[model samples]
Target: MRWKHIVAASLVLASLSGCSWVNKLVYRIDINQGNYIDQTAVEELKFGMTKEQVKFLLGPPMLVESGYPNTWYFVQYLKPGHDAPEQKELILSFDNSGQLVGMKGDYQPGSGFFEAVR
Candidate 1:
């Protein structure tokens, strides 16, 4: 009679193990969102490059909510596990004539970002 009870409990446990929510408890899903910018491409930026040139190098901006079309924003957000979420925002400012003038972002650009790196 005890063996029968053990067998019955085993069936119930096996059925519960197949539940999707149970799997969620054991495994955590990784979250990846937004565009990935290349550091090498950013190094290619020049002071007088046009918007078209910047776009060709870095792809389109994720958001341009500064109400200025000349200002382009590239953002990449990643949250993994219980740690702090990773955030990267790249800002490109274009002059009135549509030429790129400045850039600010999470990248350091290194000492020779604009120049050749040895």
Candidate 2:
């Protein structure tokens, strides 16, 4: 009888642990829905623009590549729980020489620009 109780208690504990794991998975923030830039802005980037100029034009980039001074990155993401899917990305090669090199864009699940939020 004591062994039966122990087994039942163990099963309860196991189920509770499984539930916690499932909750964590379900509530996880999808880091993808945060994109605020669009393709028109990307297309407007010119090779001779300075960093300050770029900031003025497109606001700040989501990331700036370290050790690569000339590299600037702009990224937008949408997470799954939200109205859209999350985005993960990298932009390469912006230099102080007033030259833009190797600018790139990446999107997942679909390919297109996310309309600016406002």
Candidate 3:
């Protein structure tokens, strides 16, 4: 009778644990958002590249503010990580003459020197 009671209790516990709501407790995933631009890609950008050239090199800006037409923004964001999301951005500004004159972001603009891999 004790063995039967023990078996019944174990089955009840197991069934309860297998409930649909319990699935969420074990399965979790991280989300990655926005463009993941490579530093090398941005390095290829020169001081006076045209908008078409810039788009070809870096793809379209992930977010474009309608109010600021000349300023382009590229952003990368990751979510739900142990550390802060691997977030970074690059902002490029163009002159009325349509030449790139400014770059401001977490990354430094290239000095046109390639790093030696050796």
**Which predicted model would earn the best TM-score?**
3
Collision count of model 2? 16
| Candidate 3 displacement at residue 75 in angstroms | 0.7
Off by over 4 Å in 1: 1-25, 110-118
Using Cα atoms with residue i matched to residue i, what is each candidate's TM-score against the true structure? 0.65, 0.50, 0.66
What TM-score does candidate 1 reach? 0.65
lDDT of 1 by residue, 1-118 (tens): 9999999999999897776666557755567778788888877787777888778988888987667988888988888754579889889888789977677879655344455321
lDDT of 2 at 24: 56
Model 2 lDDT per residue over 61-100, tens place: 7766577667767667666553456565647455557555
Candidate 1: lDDT over CA atoms?
0.78
Winner on TM-score (2 vs 3): 3
Q: Any idea what lDDT model 3 has?
A: 0.78
Work out candidate 2's RMSD over C-alphas.
8.1
Q: Per-residue lDDT for 1-118 in model 3, tens only?
A: 9999999999999997776666555655677888778888888877777788889988899877898888999998877533455788999887777767778897776775233121
The lDDT values for all models are 0.78, 0.60, 0.78
Q: What TM-score quantifies how close candidate 2 is to the native fold?
A: 0.50
Candidate 1, residue 25: lDDT = 70
